[model samples]
Target: SFRRSNVSPRFLHSNSTSHTWPFGAIAMLIDNAYDPDVSAKQFWIDKTVVKDQDCLTFMDNGYGLDLRTMHKMLSFGFSDKTTVKGVQPIGIYGNGFKSGSMRLGKDAIVFSKSKSTSCVGMLSQTYLEKIGAEQIIVPIVCFDQTKSDKHILDLMQ
Candidate 1:
């Protein structure tokens, strides 16, 4: 059975675009992560469990979750919502993060600003095992004001 859930934008992962899409922008963010000049920009690499596939996974941590959205959802959003559970197109509702992680990694790590985050959070191989899901979403870096302001982290107070 299939049901709809209104879980919006945990990450800013855009829906796939055929044309007029910025492959350039995606490349730039990846580039900036590795750039020597950008100190606020950090690179988290999971070198051990490569699986050697030609795929790159990027997660946006804190860009979309501003105060207004949080408050709106907090007020009236909770009362009228229904999240389903099953293996569907995205494969496993509501449990995507856990399901996906279980299917991917034996170990995981979450490279986040939060020091309390687990290594298992970022590494997908182990994550899949833990969550017992076919897919999972991990929020990686925060594209905050530093990236957009053009000031640079090394120069800030």
Candidate 2:
């Protein structure tokens, strides 16, 4: 037998409320990039217009997440961070991405490229609300970098 569990979209907003200030939410993302697993040497944040909507984009020169890792990151309460070379990871609870992204906007799309794989995932309150979704739904797509997939090329652009 199999069991199903659903998470409400409202939970995203509720979780984000833990951050008293917006800066705290942004700090969470920054800390994640600096964490041992990622060890990002550079991170960039920029404002851009996408599909007529203003958006903020974040990019990092870290070890990017694979498909499974990206899924876990978007889900609730799953963290695999470990201390490396005496540097302890700051995100231990695995709720930071949800709290931080939801605090900043109604939607977030993550595009990550590891050495062998590339993936895209979305956590979108706007999409959920628009579709009248009763439970949160995350869509993720993965691409093998070795293949010449048009989807991968499109994502890169």
Candidate 3:
């Protein structure tokens, strides 16, 4: 029903290349964490600096993500909240997830869990450049009650 447009790899790379880290990206992430629809309550931001590693972590007690939400979150220029009738969304372009993670580092792993589902996905700029991938395939596994507990534990490990 919809026709796909031709987008060159160079264009994709250049378009995403940001010389400076944008604070809006961070704000977008926090805004999404607090969005009413997300049902997030407790939120946390953690930063650590060690000898070999310096990292930041953001966590929230949201409803977590389903497949569709995760896909839209990562897609360039795609956002469902922008069309909402009454509410105003903080982000319009849906660049928050991608751009924010990129600003943090070259690699990020997103993990989400709900009553019925739990999934893990990784984004790595180095990997993308090496593979010349136009799109990111976030491998997802739907788990049963027994596996869900174990899977979440393993992911944490």
Candidate 1 Cα errors over 4 Å, as ranges? 1-14, 18-22, 25-49, 57-113, 119-157
Q: Residue by residue across 1-157, what tens digits does model 1's lDDT show?
A: 7875433322112211211334443443344333232222444433332666434455443322222222222221222212324312221122223223323323333333322221112334334345554433342332234344533222100
Compared with the true structure, what per-residue lDDT tens digits does model 3 show for residues 1-49?
Answer: 8978654334434544562555655666788886655747888888876
Residue 13 miss distance in model 1 (angstroms): 9.3
Q: Which segments of model 3 are wrong by more than 4 Å? A: 1-3, 6-22, 48-51, 82-87, 144-157
Per-residue lDDT of 129 in model 1: 45
Where is the poorest 10-residue window by lDDT in model 3?
148-157
lDDT of 1: 0.31
- Model 1 clash number: 28
The Cα local distance difference test for each model comes to 0.31, 0.87, 0.63
lDDT of 2 by residue, 34-79 (tens): 9999999999999999899989888899999887788898899899
Give the per-residue Cα lDDT of candidate 3 at 152: 35
Question: Which TM-score value belongs to model 2?
Answer: 0.89
Best by the TM-score measure = 2
